[model samples]
Target chain A: MSAITFIDYAGVAVFAATGALAASRKQLDIVGFIFLAAVTGIGGGTFRDLILGVPVFWVANRDYVLICTVVALVVFFGAHRVESRYKLLLWLDAIGLAVFAVIGAAKGMAITGSPAVSIIMGMLTACFGGILRDLLAGEPSVLLRPEIYVTAAIIGAGIYTGCELLHLPGPVSYLSGVFAAFAVRGGA
Target chain B: MSAITFIDYAGVAVFAATGALAASRKQLDIVGFIFLAAVTGIGGGTFRDLILGVPVFWVANRDYVLICTVVALVVFFGAHRVESRYKLLLWLDAIGLAVFAVIGAAKGMAITGSPAVSIIMGMLTACFGGILRDLLAGEPSVLLRPEIYVTAAIIGAGIYTGCELLHLPGPVSYLSGVFAAFAVRGGA
Candidate 1:
């Protein structure tokens, strides 16, 4: 698999786990856990694909669905043993956000050839999953907060788009974007 | 415009009005009203189109967006003068749901030719706008309630799909579906 594919899978898994964690906190049933996981894992990408007029990635490849389900099940069964669930959730979310932002920006650039659009796509892809998760859980969405989440996504996407415009090496640009997003989120 | 297009526009306008009403309850700004209205009007169709691998209807045609925006603005400015907002909201929502279900079922049948899939698409198109609006406004989704909302959507969609499979005339199937949904909702 390509680097982007690998990161995408990782992002989906982490997001799915976070969704399961949220479901567990809500004391939802197994089906609810699965639904939340799937939506959180794929919602952002699905929204981006729809806006870009492309086939939804998870729909085209059932493997992504399988991965999300498996991750959700694992998290549902195992998360109780982990201490500091909130900390773990935050870190996993930060990692997922960074990876998804990079992947989304790259995809947007490939499809639209517009740096501004790519950056916006990146931000949307990184943030929308958590937004959906929060919405479904009936919690205040992070978007309503004065937090640094969206700003971090914007920074990462902007960096990636700028590097691509400068013709930077692919891996270099991607790693830089991820690092920037992570740092911003971690610092916040 | 075709019959479907006419109903689609009407569905969008009614949905937008509901969304604007929702925003009014939240005491949100005008921008929030517009955002909620647009999402409520288009969210379901967008989700259906993405799953079906088709171009999003609103994105493909800017007129839908314009209609949603105009309706939102009108509702935002006029809704306060209206007494019995709850009754009006319910009736408008019922109309939007029926029209959206028929349009969604038709589109799904035209694309997939699967009765079950068409029925599901119809229900999703009918119900998800309200779901999104509730989520955005931090209200408990109607899905979590024991209300007859989703049941009404399912009845309508199933009727539409069944009629199509029996080779019923276009308008007959459409009106029957709408009437069935409306009766179920209104009765509840």
Candidate 2:
């Protein structure tokens, strides 16, 4: 698999785990856990694809759904043994957000050839999973928070899209975007 | 415009009004009203289109967005003047739900040629907007309620899809579906 694909899978796994954790907190059944996990893993990409008039990525690739289900199952059975579950969820989600933001921007740029739309796509990709999870779990959405989550996504997406528009090398642009997002979110 | 298109516009207007009313209840700004209105008006169709690998409907027709905005603006400015706002909201939403359900089922059948999937599409189209509105407003979703909302949608969608599959006349199928949905929701 390509490095980008690997990163995307890792990001999806972490997001799915977070969804499963939320299900546990809600005392939902196993079906609920799987449902939440799949939605959280795929929601952002689905929204982006719909807006860009592209076939949804997860629907086209069954492995992504399988990965999310496996990750959720693992978390469901083992999350109680972990210390600082909330902290772990936050940190892992942040990492996933940063990675997904870069990937979303790249995909948006390729599809629409518009830097403005590409940045918005990046932000949507990075944060929409958490938004869906919170909405489904009846938690306060991070979008309504005063935190730096969406801001971090915007920064990452903007940097990547801008770099691409400037004709920067792919690796350099990717690294710059990911590092910027990680720093902003971690620092916040 | 076709009769179906006219019904769609009316449904969208009603949905937008409900969303704007929700924003008013939350005492959100005009921007929040617009956002909620747009989401409520188009969320279901967007999900349906995404699943069917079709272009999002509202994006292709800017008039839908304009209608939503106008309806939201009216609601934002005039909701407090109306007596029994909650009752109005419920009735309007029920009508929108029934209309959208039939439309969604028709669209799904056209795209996938499966009555089962078409019924699911109808349910999603009828109920997803309220699901999204409640989620964003931090209110309990209608799905978690004991009401007959989704049940009514299923009946309507099922009747419509079944009639089409059985080669019934178009007008008969349409009226049967709408009348069934209206009776179920209104009776409950």
Candidate 3:
């Protein structure tokens, strides 16, 4: 798989973990965990694809759905053993945010070739999944918590778009974007 | 204009009005009202189109966006005068539910030509917008209530699909679907 596609899978895995964690806290059954994980893992990308009028990524390839389901199953049993699921969730979310930001920007750049649109798409892709997770789980949104989450995604996407505009190497740009987003999210 | 297209517009307007009313209850500013209205008005069709791998209806034609915005503007200015916003909201919601159920099923039949898929599409289209509105507004979802909201949509969609299976005339099938939905909803 290409680097972007790999990162997209990683992002889906992490986001699915977060969603399953949320489901655990809600005391939902196994089916609920899977449902929540699937939505959280694919929700942002689905929205991005729809807006860009592309085939929804998971629908195009059912492997993503399988990945989410497996992650949900793992988290369902393993989550209780984690001492601080909230902290783990936050860290995993930061990683997912960074990953999705770069992947979304890369896809947007390829399709739209407009930096502004790409940046917006990146932010949407990174944040919307978490928003859906929070809303579905009835947890207070991280966005409502006065955090730097959305800003971190935007800055990461902006930096990636900037690097592309400056003719940076592909790997260099992607690494830079992910690190920047992780730093912002972690530091906050 | 086709009956389905006209009802689609009407559905958007009524759903937008309900969203604006929800915002009013939350004491949101005009911008929030508009945001909520647009989401509530277009969320379901967007989901359906996305899943069907079709161009998002509102994105393909900006007129739906305009209709949502205008309805939001009117509601922002005029909502305070209504004696029972909640009651009016319920009635309007019922109308929107029926209209969208028929429109969505019709669209599904036209595209997929499968009764089961069309009925599922109808239910999703009718129920999802309201679900989004409730989630965004932090209101308890209608689905969570004992009231017969989702069931009404399913029954409505099912009836429409049944009519089509019987090879009913176009207008007859559509009208029967809408009226059956409205009766189920209103009777509840």
Candidate 4:
């Protein structure tokens, strides 16, 4: 597989695992876990599409929903024995946030032709899934806290936008943005 | 008390009660119930405004949040029987749907310029909250259902818009719309 394809698939797995773990905390059944997984996976993209007045990406392609469902099921049932026991769930979630945040910014810049909106899209994509997760989990939103999650995503998105503006290769732009977000999040 | 005001307040109460009940089912604490209550109460309105390219209603004025919280408290601790029961809650929810459906229609018709958009706004206001509640509560969305819920909101909204075009008194227009919805829902 090409490097881009490999990275994209890896991002999907990370996001699915993060969503599945959150649902597992709720003790939600397979159906519930799958529901949340799909929402957390595509919700940011859908919101981005809606705001941009584009056809929803998932509705246009059934594969997005199917991939989310299958990945969720794999993580929910098969990972149960050591899922909650995994001490690195937060670390995995942070990686997902970093990668998804950059992807969101990249997609935003591709669509809106504005860096400002691109940053907003990145934060929305990176943080909104977790926002929905926390909201449904009935916990205080991490965004509401003084935590650097949104701030980190915003900065990462800015970096991505800046890199693209400077004509850097796509892979380099993506990695730098992800690392920027990951550093802040992992530190805080 | 004005019948309209009484009915609107009752709708708010019903929505708050349902939110609290749903939160309790998740074993959420008092704060969680209050937060979820406000989300359920004003969530639809906020969503409507967001999609309309307007500022979120509650983020500007805090009154809506306060009312939802207070109503949630009353529902959670004030009425022990209500907190424990099922059937009464269903009736309350249905009434909430009927009243709010009309109110949503009226507000949407007044704010948005087009009749079609207004009808859509009304349905969004009436149905989105419940959809969010169910989605958050591990229940499938009514939007995903073929039920008459959105259909009822749209029809009632059309009635309210028709009355607006006829230059009827605002209250009368509102009342007629409300009653029409109540009758249909009650019959169902």
In candidate 3, position A44 carries an lDDT of: 91
Please give, for residues A1-188, the per-residue lDDT of candidate 1 as tens digits.
99878888999999888888887777775656776787789889988998898877865566777888898889888888989777888899999899889889999999999999999999999999999898877778879873799999999999999999999999999999999999998888
lDDT of 2 by residue, B126-185 (tens): 899988888887777888873699999999999999899889988778778888888898
What digit string (tens of lDDT, one per residue) describes model 4 on residues B1-188?
A: 77765665666667777777777677777887897777778877776666555667668766667778888787667555654545555566667777777777666665665565566566667777877887777755554342456556666767877888788998878877776766665565
Each candidate's TM vs. the true structure? 0.64, 0.63, 0.64, 0.56
Off by over 4 Å in 2: A1-43, A50-123, A133-138, A143-188, B165-169
iRMS of each prediction: 4.2, 4.0, 4.6, 9.2
Docking class of 4: incorrect
Superposed by TM-score, candidate 2 places the C-alpha of residue A142 at a distance from the truth, in angstroms, of: 2.6
2 against 3, candidate with superior lDDT: 3
The DockQ scores of all candidates, in the order shown, are: 0.18, 0.18, 0.13, 0.05
TM-score of 4: 0.56
Across residues A6-95, which tens digit of lDDT does each residue of candidate 4 receive? 565566567666677766776666655665676667667768767777665654345666677787888777766774533455777678
Candidate 3 residue pairs in clash (backbone atoms < 3 Å) = none
Clashing pairs in 4: none
Could you list the chain B TM-scores for each candidate? 0.97, 0.96, 0.97, 0.85
Evaluate model 2: give its lDDT. Answer: 0.85
For all candidates, the clash counts are 0, 0, 0, 0
